[model samples]
Target: MSASHPDNAPAATAASAQAFQTRLADRAAAMETTLTEIFNRRSAAPPRLLAAMRHAALGGGKRLRPFLTVETAALCGAEAATALPTAAAIELLHCYSLAHDDLPAMDDDDLRRGQPTVHKAFDEATAILAGDALLTLAFEVIADAGAHPSPDVRARLTLGLARAGGMTGMVGGQMLDLAAEGRWGAARLSPDDILHLQALKTGALLAFAVEAGGLVAGADADVQARLARYGKAVGGAFQIADDILDHEADAETLGKRAGKDAEKGKGTLVTALGLSGARAICDELIDGAIAALDCFGAEADMLRHAARFVGARRS
Candidate 1:
C-alpha cells in the first residue's frame, strides 16, 4: 500500500484534486451511473415520486461520502466494484438528509446545489415521501450488498449503517441541531459543544462511511482504526468548511443558498469562532485528517486529496 499522505503533501488546489480525480475519474463516473440506476428502480415506486428522488440525488455535488467509501475500500484491498453498493447506499442516506433538511419544517431552504429544493421542485408531500423512500432504500441497498459477503460480515455492515443512520447517530444529531437553534444566549454553546454537535450531526454518518467501507473491505483492526480517525477528522473538516462557505461563499459558487446559517440563527463554528478562527480550525482538521492516513502509505493519497476537497470545496 502507498502512504495515505505523501511527505510531499501537494497543495490541494482544484487543479491538483482534478488531476488526482483523473486517476479514478472513470471509475467514479461509472459508480455514479450505477448508483443512479439502482436508486431509480426502487419498488416500482411512483414515477413522480421517483423523479423527485432522482432529481434531488442526481444533481451535482462533491459525492464525497460515497467517494470515501469506495476509496477506503480500495485502500483496504477490496475491489471498488465490491464496494459500490455500500457507496451508493451511503449517498442515498446523505441525499435523504438533505431532502428532509430542506423541508418547510426544517431549514425551509428553496435552493440546494443551485436548484430548487425537493419540496420546491415537487410538492411538500412528495418531497417528504421521496426522503422517506430514500432513507428506507439505503438500508435495502446495504442489505443486498451484504448478501455478497459472508453472513456475519453482511450482518455487521447492516448493523453499522443502521446505527449510524438512525436515532443514535445522524437523526439524533439533527434533533440536537433543531433544539440548539437561536438558543445561543441561555444555552450558551461553547466551541467544544459546537464541535461535538457537528461531529454527531455531520460527522457521524461520515465516520460510519469509512468504518463500514473498511469493514466491507476486510481491513485489519489497525487499518479500521486509522480509517475511523481519518473519517472523523475529515468529517469535522467538511462541516467546518461548510460553515466557512455559509459565511463567505456566494450562492452561485456554493450551489446552495448562502448565509442561511446566520439567517436561521443557527450556532455554528463560524458563529462561535469568528471567520478567521473557523478557517484556521478547518486547516487544523485537514492536517489531522491527513495525519490519520499516515499508516496507509501511498494508497492514501486519494484519501488525502479527499480531505483537502472537504476542507476547501466551494459547494
Candidate 2:
C-alpha cells in the first residue's frame, strides 16, 4: 500500500493500521538487535556492568521515539538506512531516562516493560551506572560517522540530542516535577504549569525525535520547524494518555505500578484538569499534531496515525 493517504480519510483503516503496526514492530526489532550487538561486542566492561547495561537497553517497549525518527526521515525523503543509527541513539537516550526515572529517588517503580526494573533486577548503583552509560553512549552513537556520512549532520544530531536531554529540557522538567510534589514547599501546579512541565520533560525528546529526521535529511528550515511543532503536540498527547492510563490501567497492562502519580503527589494534567478535561486536552493536541503535518500532504499519513495512536492507547 502507498504510504500516502487522503487528508480527510481516517488516519488508519484496520488493514493500514496493521501495516503501521508491522512497520513499528520491524523497526523495534531491528533496534533491539543493534543494541544487543553493541553491548555484546564490548570486551572492556565488567561482566555485571555490561549485563546491567544490556538488560536496561537491549529489550522491551514500543520503540516509538525511534519510529518517529525513522518515519520523519522517510517523510523528508531520506532512506531509513541513513537514519537508523540516529534512531538507535534516540532509543538509547529514552531507555536511559526510563532507567533513571524508575530509581528509588524518582518514580521508585519496581517494574518496567513487564520485567523487573533495572534497579530491581540489579543493585541500585548498577542501575544508576547502567543508565549513565546508556546516556553517554547515546551521544557517542549520534556523533559517530555511522550515524551520518556528513560530519555536520552528525554534529547537529549530537547537539540537538544534548539540548533535548539536558537540564533545560528533560532534566529541568524532572526537577520541576519533583518540586511540584511539594518537596520544597512549592504550591501545587496549575493546569498551565503542568502542561509546561510535561512539554519540557516529556515533549522535548519527542520533538527532537521528529526533528532529527528532518535534520538527517537536510530538510529546509520551514519543514523542520513544522515537524518540531508536530512533535511538541504529539508529546503533549502522549503524556496525557499516560496520565489517563496511570489512573485506570492495571500493573500487568501498564507494565508498572498504576496511580503512582497521585500516590506520590506528582502534579499531572489529570490531577489539574480531571479525567474528561484531560481527555479533551489530549484530543486537542492530537488535532494540532495532525494539522502541523498538513504541509507534508499524504506523505505524513503514518505520523497522523501515530498521533491518534498516542491519544487512544490503553497502556
Candidate 3:
C-alpha cells in the first residue's frame, strides 16, 4: 500500500488491507499478554481489587489505541519492545474510562464486550476503585524506565498522558457531553461544538497515542506534529462511525447498549448531519488523516489502513 499506488488498483489495496488486519490482530494479542503479566505482577494488591481491575482491563475490545501507539512507533523506526509499556499504559487509561463510563451515574450500561460490565460483575465501589487504580497505574507504567530509555522521553510521555486524560481533555469532554444532554437546556449543539467536544473527549488520548510513539522514537517536532494531526483526524472519524453504529447496530453487535445517544437526547453531529451526512463527514476526516501521513509515504500504510478502519468499522 505505497502512496504511489494508483487509486484504481484494488488488488494491491485489498492485499494491504489484509496485511494490516493481520498485523493489528498480532499486535493486539501481544498487548493482551503484556497487560496480563503486568496485572499478575500486582500480587500484593487486595485480591478483590485486583480481580476488578483484571475484569475491566483484560480480555477486551480491539485495542486500537495501543495498536496505534505501537504502529506509530514502528513508523518512526522504534522497536516494538520499547513501545509496549507505553501502549499498555494507554490501554489501561482507556479501560479506566470505560469502567467509569459504564457506572450507574454515567451511561448506566450493563454490558461491555459481550460480558457484564465491571460494575455489574463486581460492585459499583469495586468498579470505581478499579477505574481509579487503572488510571493511577497508567502514570506509573509511563514513568518506569522500561517505557523509554531516556529520562526525558519518560517525562514527556507522563506529561502528555496526564494532559490527555485530565480535566482539559477526556474529562472535560465528558462534562460537556453531560451538559449537552439538556442538563443545561442545550440538547442540540452546533457541528463545531460537537467537533470541539468530541475532539477533547475522544481525540485527545488518541492523539497522545500517536505522539507518544513519536516521543519514544525521538522524532523531530515536525514529524510529531504530523502524527498528532493524523491521530486527531482519525479519532474524530472514529467517533462519527461510533455514532452511526449506535443508530444502526444492535446491542448484540455493539456488545453494549445501542442507540443510547438518541434515547438520552445526547447531541451529536449525527443529529445535525443525519446518517448520510455523518458518513460523509467521516469519509472526509479519513481522507485528512491519510493525507497527514503523506510525508511518511509507504511507512505510513498501516496508519492509512487504521484511519480507514476507524471510519468503516462495524463495532
Candidate 4:
C-alpha cells in the first residue's frame, strides 16, 4: 500500500532527494578509488582480495546512510565535504555487512544489487575475507582526516562507530532476527520490542551516522539529541519499509531476492502487523523522525525530506 505521511510536504516534494542519491553515488565511487589506491600501494594485499572488496563495496546501493552522515554534518554548519571519509567508512562497513549477510551461514542469498552476491561472484572464503578487509579498512578511513576535529571527538566517533557496527550492535540485532525466525513473527513484538530490535540493528548505525557528523561539527547537546531522535525514527521507518517491500516488491525491482524473509520465516513488521498496519506504523515513524528536526528550523528541510524518503525507498 502507498503510505501517507502527516507532514505538509508531499513525499513527491522530495524531488531533490533523487539528486542527493546521484551525488552520493558519485562520492562513493571516489571513495572506492581512494580505497583501491591505498590497497594497491601495498603489494602484499592480494589482487583477488582487493577485487572482491571493490566488487562488493563499489556495487550499487542507495548510499542513504552515508548521505545522512554528510548532510547532518552540513546542517549543523560544518562543511559536508569534510565528513567524506566518515561517510565512506560507514558505507564500507555497510557493504561488508551485506556481503556476510548473503553468505551460506547468514541470509544465504545469491544475488545483491541485481548482480551475483560476493560469495556467488567469488568463493565463500574470498567473500568472508573481503568483508573482513572492508570492516578493518573502515576504521582506517575514519581515523584518516575527516574525524570531528578534536582528538577526543575523533576517539568518540571511533568508539561510536565500532559500537554501532560490531557484534554488540548491528550483529546483535541480526542474531535476534535470526533467532526469531519462525517463532516470534511480528505479532509477538510489543511496540517496545520492535523499538528495541530496530534501535540496535537498524537505528544504531544511523544514530552513529547522524551523531558522528554532529559530533564532528561540535554540535551542542540539544542538537545531538535531536539528530539522535531523528536517526532512530528514520532507522525504524527504513526497516518497516523494507519489511513491506519484502512482501510487495518483485525481485527485478528490488535488485535482490524478494520474499526471502517470509520464505525463511523471519519476523517483520508486516508479518506482525499485516500490510496496512506496517504502512501505518511507517508513516507514524516518519512523522516522529521529521518532528525531531523541528529545532533546526528551515535548515532541516533536507533531513525532513530524507526521513520521508526513507519510508518511501523501494530497496
How well is each residue in 1-315 modelled by candidate 1, as lDDT tens digits? 122234536454567667777855665686679667786566487899889989878857667777788888889988887888888888889999999999988888899988999999999999999999888988888888443467777788889888888777888878777777854344567899888888888998998888878988898888888888889998898888888888888998887788988887777988988998988888887788888887766678888887876765676
- Ranking, lDDT, top scorer first: 3, 2, 1, 4
Q: All candidates: CA RMSD in angstroms?
A: 3.3, 2.8, 2.4, 2.9
TM-score of 2: 0.95
Q: State residue 50's C-alpha deviation in candidate 2, in Å.
A: 1.2
Candidate 4, pairs of clashing residues = 186-272, 187-272
Q: Report model 4's TM-score to 2 decimal places.
A: 0.90
* Total clashing pairs for each candidate: 7, 0, 0, 2
Q: Write the per-residue lDDT of candidate 4 for residues 1-315, one digit (tens) a residue.
A: 134654534344345667655665765576566555656665577989989988897747777777788788889888877777788788888888999999988899998999999999999999999999989988887876545557787788789889999787898888777776634444355656666776777778877888888887889999899898988888888888888898999999999999998898776778777898988888988888888887666667767777877877787
Q: Write model 2 residue lDDT over 1-315, tens digit each, in one string.
A: 223223433546788778788888998898888777767667688889888888887778888998899999999999987888999898889889999999999889999988999999998999999999999988988998889999988888999999999898898999999999888896678899999999889999998999999999999999998998899999988999999999989999998899899898889988888898998888888878888887777678888888877887876
TM, every model: 0.92, 0.95, 0.96, 0.90
Indicate the worst ten consecutive residues by lDDT in candidate 4: 1-10
lDDT of each: 0.81, 0.87, 0.88, 0.80
lDDT of 3 at 306: 86
lDDT, residue 217, candidate 4 = 80
